[model samples]
Target: MRVVNIHERVYRAEPDALGALLGTLASRGDRLWPVGAWPKMAFDRPLQVGATGGHGPIGYRVEAYRPGRSVWFAFLRPAGFAGGHGLEIEALGEGRTLLRHRLEMTISGVARLSWPLAFRPLHDALVEDALTRAEIELDLPPTVRRWSPRVRVLRWIVSGGSARPQALAG
Candidate 1:
């Protein structure tokens, strides 16, 4: 089966500013991913086509890259998650833009079980937190006021009650 996940957030900042922020996502995942919340996003070297490294156990190689714009990483681990994921920035004009993360893949075997039972819930919460972090980086108010019950429960179960999202000031 194929699975796809997409998340987006709009920011009121210069297009270039948003793009610059997005570029940092590769090496500076701490800026994007909440702390102590699941595994942090990390990569070796700056994002560029053909560079290798990714977050946690799921390995990846930089499949595509555009400075201050977008980047895609093709997965290289965790069996059956055969595809790629990445982030992009889109200009909306006059000091506004959009940031998006997309994961598209064909899944089979173990991933089918792990995704819904563990990764799915965690992934949803992480994406939301990432967007909130963006707001904080831009000195804007947070959009996520509180963690959802589902997310909280899932985090406890998955991370042994140690999942502390690097929440933005709400």
Candidate 2:
């Protein structure tokens, strides 16, 4: 089955400002990736086509890129997850931007079961935390969270104690 998962947040910053943060998405020391609750998105080099990295179990290589705009990473691991995920900035005007993270893939074989069972919940939380961190950097408030009990439970199951939920400060 081909599944697409998209998560997005609006930030109180221009597209350029928010897009520049991509430089930090794929590096061990990326100051922009939220460290407290999400896996650090890291790559061996700067964000560019062919650059490879991922947040942990999920892995990908940069398939397309636009500086200060968008990036798409084609999955390289968790076999059968054949497609791509990426970050995009949509200029919402009036000094605001919409930051979007999207995952699109055709799940087959073991990945079909693994993605929903092991990845979805934690992935959702991680994306939200990353966006919240971006909002904080832009001097805005974190988005209101909707962590359902099922999500929380899934987090605990996948990440062990590291899935501890934090107070979403506005």
Candidate 3:
């Protein structure tokens, strides 16, 4: 299966300001990733090219980085996943900036089943939550996206039927 997924949000902030948030991605003071809700993103080294890590069951290595502009990661786990994903800050002129998350990959073997049935739904929810975090941190009026029923159920299963997972709580 080939998948190309993209999620983005426009903020009334300059590229430099948005880049500052992007720079905090996996750090202790991460103002973008929904760390408490989802598995935290960590790397053997600081955020830079070649830094390796990924949240939860996903594993990846940073393939490229542009301090305040973008970060691209190449997949290294889940068996048949081939390709990469990245986050980018695009300037939209007039003090507006677009924060975009894009995933492009081809899944073979078990991934063909897993990507559509499990990973894709969870990934969508996580990305939306991350974008919401950015909006809250930037003091922008947030446009929150609710988890779909499928996402809620998956989170329940993944969390072992406990109370709503932090990722699904807010």
Judging by TM-score against the true structure, name the best candidate. 3
> What is the Cα-based lDDT of residue 101 in candidate 2?
96
| Candidate 1 Cα outliers beyond 4 Å, as residue runs | 28-30, 36-38
* Tens-digit lDDT string for candidate 2 (53-149): 8877888999999888888899999787899888899999998899999998899999878889767776786778778878877778667566767
What ranges in model 3 sit over 4 Å off? 163-170
Measured with C-alpha atoms, the lDDT of residue 113 in candidate 1 is 94
Spell out the clash pairs found in candidate 1. none
Best by lDDT: 3
**Cα lDDT of model 3 by residue, 1-170, tens digit:** 78999999999999998899999988888888987778789888889999999998999999999999999999999799999999999999999999999999999999999999999999998999998888888888777788888988888888788635445234
When 1 and 2 are scored with lDDT, the better candidate is 2
The total of clashing pairs for model 3 equals 0
The sequence of per-residue lDDT tens digits that candidate 1 reaches over residues 1-170 is 88989999889987687676777665645466555544766666776788887666678889998888888889998788899888888988878889899999998998999888777776777778788878887888779847678777776676677766644565
For model 2, state the Cα shift of residue 109 in Å: 1.3
The 10 consecutive residues of candidate 1 with the worst lDDT sum are 29-38
Residue 131 displacement in candidate 3 (angstroms) = 0.9
**Cα-lDDT of candidate 1:** 0.77
What pairs collide in candidate 2?
26-42, 26-43, 27-42
Better model by TM-score: candidate 1 vs candidate 3: 3
